[model samples]
Target: MTYCVGLLLNEGMVLLSDTRTNAGLDNIATYRKMFTFEKPGERVIVIMTAGSLSVTQTTIARLREAIDDKDSTPDQSIMLAPTMLKVAEIIGNALASVRLDIESKMEASKVSTSASMIVAGQRRGGGMRMFLVYPEGNFIEATEDTPFLQIGEHKYGKPILDRVARMDMSLDEARKAMLLSMDSTLRSNLSVGMPLDLVIIHKDDCQISERRRIEKGDPDFSRMSEMWSEALRDGFTKIQI
Candidate 1:
């Protein structure tokens, strides 16, 4: 019940995620959905999560634990994984294991405990890569044919991405594309709300080039939303049935 999107462009990688989590209409709260891991110029990995908070949080916690463990190895810690593909595999396996454990423990209550994540990053000497990690320890990478991946209340915002995004898009344009995509979802879904977390990592830089938190009523975002609304209305008026 949240929206998180990542774009893998020739220029860099752009990521955005809403901070809203809702147990019910009256039980809404803001919890950051974006997590970043980096060793400055050496490596950088940004994870945007959606779905059950318990699953995503635990998966991240375990990853961090491995990173901090003095005995961690390439197979155990994502930061030490030789390649981004191996990192995704480790995360997928961790996520699947945590989800299964949680589901088993909650069997008596018959609750669902599943989640998915978008894993994007680059190593100092490696190329930028992005993947959509599924709930069952499997994933698909972003390719030139589709240089983007999204998770959560994604249906409401996918149209704009499909119509406008491309592999060669500039970082600036990619950021706008994702914000507007999130804007569309925000307007149509109550489960997804502000503030939004956005991050941009320039290719091979192995560090976050830009990061921002857009809170509710942030002037710039508000203006963009209003402009989009007016444009939509104008477009509707110009159309003839």
Candidate 2:
């Protein structure tokens, strides 16, 4: 249980994920959920995951292995994939394959190994794209009608996105929206916790333009959270009901 979200706006893309994983109340630990693969100006891809750690970790490892394999073809390696759609397909296949293999071994134990990911990136000479990859290897792309995608403990933060996300919003606004959305989830969910990873990639840059790790008690995030709470209370007072 974690929360990961990505916004695809006209200006660029903004991705955020929490770094918390817990097997039980006493077994909580922090493990980064965001992974990035970049070739600077030629291409860049960011993957934010949620669900079984084993599944996500193995899926990512396999992707990296494919990229590093000298014999890998354009279809076999995400870095060389001609389009973002192909990249998503490659990831989907890997995720599905890994998940099936793990599930087969863990079947008798009845342990859950489900996982999902949000993939976002751009390749040189192409427009940016984002997709939400399902646990079964299928995915749905973010389009103009829905410029954002979310995974994990997403319900707690989806309201703001539904009301405010837009295809034309600036990257700065998207960043604020993403933080506020995560803040909402942090307050409502115990499974999702601190040291959030955030990344911003400007359209056509084919690289991570900016990145930040917002740890627990970070002054700026704390202040923003407090201000948001206060604003909500003030707004509540103004309501006629």
Candidate 3:
């Protein structure tokens, strides 16, 4: 299991994902769940993944292969896709294909394969867009009514987003909101742990504005987590039964 979240705000897009992958209590390990592709001023795309590692990795590998294939056309390569929507479609199709292929191979062993992803990006002349692509090649977009999307161990962190996030929120506030959201998940779930990958892309800039990796015991993350915990406790204490 894992926890990954992305916020689509008027200012820009913010994304965060934990690196933990737990096969069992004794089999815990770290693997990056965030992947980014950019042509700097022309386009920027960020993908945060959750679910079976095999499926996610293979899906990404195929996308990269298409990008590098000299014979690949715009319809197939994400970097050349005419629009962000086409990029999402290409990704969704590849993800679904990889999943089905893996599931077929795992049939003899009775194992299952599935994964989902959040796709966020913008092209120089196009509008910013964000999508939640399901394992079955279907998706939903972020809208003004709900300006965020999340996957994996998402429930623990969803409350904060619901109450605090809005399309008009500043990029700084959006980043904080997501960090706190991840903090809540870290407290409630052992399957989700650090280090965390965070990226921010300013609208129409078509490039990542900032990126950070928050490792376990990093002073800043530690301070933020402690502060959030103390605030939660104080809030609870102030409430009357």
In order, candidate lDDTs are: 0.94, 0.95, 0.94
User: Model 2, residue 221: displacement in angstroms?
Assistant: 0.6
lDDT over C-alpha atoms for residue 154 of model 2: 92
lDDT string for model 2 (110-222, tens) is 88889999999999998899999999999999999999999999999999999889989999889888899999999999999999999999988999999999989999999
- Runs of candidate 3 exceeding 4 Å displacement: none
Q: Which candidate, 2 or 3, would have the higher TM-score against the true structure?
A: 2
For model 1 the TM-score comes to: 0.98
Against the hidden reference, what TM-scores do the models get?
0.98, 0.98, 0.98
Candidate numbers sorted by TM-score from highest down? 2, 1, 3
Clashing pairs in 3: none
Worst 10 residues of 2 by lDDT: 20-29
Which consecutive 10 residues in model 1 have the weakest lDDT in total?
105-114
Model 2, runs deviating above 4 Å: none
* lDDT (10s digit) by residue, model 1, range 1-241: 8899999999999999999997768999999999999999999999989888999999999999999999999998999998999999999999999999899888898667879999999997889999999999899999999998999999989999999999899999999999999999999999999999999999889999999999899999999999989999999999999
